[model samples]
Target: MEDAEIIRLVLAGHHEQYAGLVQRYQEPLILFLRRILNSEEDSFDCAQEAFLAAYRNLNRYSKEYPFRAWLYAIARNKALDLMRKRHREVLSIPDETMVDQRPNPEEVVLAKEETALLSEVLHELPEQYGQALYLRYRQELSYKEIAMVLQVPVSSVKTYIHRGKEKLRQILERREIRGGKGQPIMEEIISR
Candidate 1:
């Protein structure tokens, strides 16, 4: 069923319907939280809190916006709150064991290196820009949806995404060169 339908059912007191929502969103929510919190345990805990908050505030959900976006907004807020309470910076390297599944050795090694670079660069970004970029590319949220989540104008979302992409490109280019690479052979793929 569509998320809207599921939400309607959930709000109507069909609590079982919430299970479907949770199943549908759990992975993305967890992954998003993981990127922000950099800890599997914390991500899972924040994801649960996000879902519970969403459920409790269901009456305020606007049907005009995508339900998934709304859920992500809640999740993002919870993750940010946790980060503040911990008094730590965002975008640290995640624990290796926290990965949901293992890749082949070669793939895992490459992924770990890339993730470390990305994390370092992401930590350098200002909070709003970092969050916007992560939400846009990693979580695959639309500009409109992101604007809604961040409580900002759509134009602001576009500006942040544009600037964030430029910064990320610079970071990647510097890393690639330092690692003894020339222009990305997969320039097309990277651009995409």
Candidate 2:
């Protein structure tokens, strides 16, 4: 079922139906939070809190907006709140790789290594740039959706995404030059 339908069911007094929304977004929400907190426990807690907040504020959810974007906005706020309380800069990509279910051994290892390098480069970017890249590419959110989540204007979201991609390109070029490596890992990372 669609999020709108699930939400309508919840708002119509089928409180148990809210679980559908939770199950739908649980993994991505937790993974996003984990990137911010770098702790599985903390990420889970934040995701839980975000879901609760969403439930409590369900009535305020506008049907005009995409449910996933709205949920991500809540999750982002919850993560920022937790970070403020903890006062830490421990954000790093979790050790998760998007490998195929059935993969060649050598290809899997290379993918893992490349992913690790890409993660480091991403984290090294300025927060806004990194976040823009993550939300735009990794999460596959549209500009309008990202604007909603980031509480920014659509123009700003576009600018951020463009700059983020350019910044990533520059970083990769610098690395390639410094390493003097013939590998096109940078292109692979960006093209992927």
Candidate 3:
């Protein structure tokens, strides 16, 4: 079912319909939170809080924006709040345990190596650029959706993404020259 129709049904007193939205977005939302929080438990908690907040504020949700973007904006706000309360910076890392379900052991090792390298490179970037790149490439959000989530203009989103990619490419190139065995993988990533 369409998100709009589900939302309409939910607002019209069929509160159970909200579960469908939750089911649809829960995993991706939690993954997004995890990247920001860097703690599995905290990410799950934040995801729940964000979902609750979204539900309560459903009436104020504008239809002009994509529902996924709106939900991500809520999630991002929740993550920022949690970080403020903790009074510390969160170091984002990809979960090592999360690997492709393919049975090949070699593929799993390559996946882990790639994830580690990407995370290390992202950490070196300015925080905002790292986040912009993550949202654009990792989450596959539209530029407009990323702008909404970041509370920035679409033009800013475009600039951030472009600059971020340029910076990432430079970092990868340096790694390729310094690292022998990882050169091919780094070059492939840079080519992408």
Candidate 4:
């Protein structure tokens, strides 16, 4: 069923329909939360809280807005709340070795190393830029969708993406310089 239909059902007091919404968005929501929280446990908790909050506040959701975007806005707020409650503690990197579902060992190792490095760089970014990059690249959300989800103007979204990419390039260049490498892995990824 479409998200709007499901949401209509939810608003009509079919609370069970909320579970379908949760199931549909669980993975993406968890992945987004994991990127922000850097802890699987915390991400799971925050995702659940977000879903529950959305369910409780369903009546307030405007039908004009896309349901998924509204849902993510709730999730983002929940994540920010969690962060604030925790006094903005720095999240540690997830253990790359634990992600063992790889078909090729060599490729898995390379991917893990690259992921760790990229995660480090992403964490160093300002929150808005980091979120813009994550939403654009990781979630594969379009510029319009990201602006809606973030409740930002489309022009602001464009500016954020442009500035974020430039900042990311600078970070990669610095890494390459420190490592005595000519170009960073990001250059290769971008070129492709």
Q: What is candidate 1's local distance difference test score?
A: 0.76
Best by lDDT: 3
TM-score for each candidate, following the candidate numbering: 0.81, 0.88, 0.91, 0.83
Alpha-carbon local distance difference test for all models: 0.76, 0.79, 0.82, 0.75
Worst 10 contiguous positions by lDDT, candidate 3: 182-191
Order the candidates by TM-score, highest first — what do you get?
3, 2, 4, 1
Stretches of candidate 2 off by over 4 Å are 98-100, 177-192
Query: What digit string (tens of lDDT, one per residue) describes model 3 on residues 3-105?
Result: 9999999899999999999999998888788778898899899999988999999999999998899999999999999899999778586664474687888
Best-fitting candidate, scored by TM-score: 3
Q: Ten-residue segment with the worst summed lDDT in candidate 1?
A: 181-190
- Candidate 2 vs 4: which has more lDDT: 2
- What would the per-residue lDDT of candidate 1 be over residues 11-50, giving only the tens digit for each residue? 8889899989899999888887887788889999999999
Model 3: lDDT to the true structure:
0.82
* Cα lDDT tens digits for candidate 2, 1-192: 989899999999999999999998999888777777888999999999999999999999998779988988998898888788878666676656663564677766766776577678888788777776677766778888888888888899888877776777888787764244432454543554
lDDT (tens digit, per residue) of candidate 4 on 4-109: 8898887887879888889999988888877778779988998899898888888898876677777787887787788889887453334444646878887777
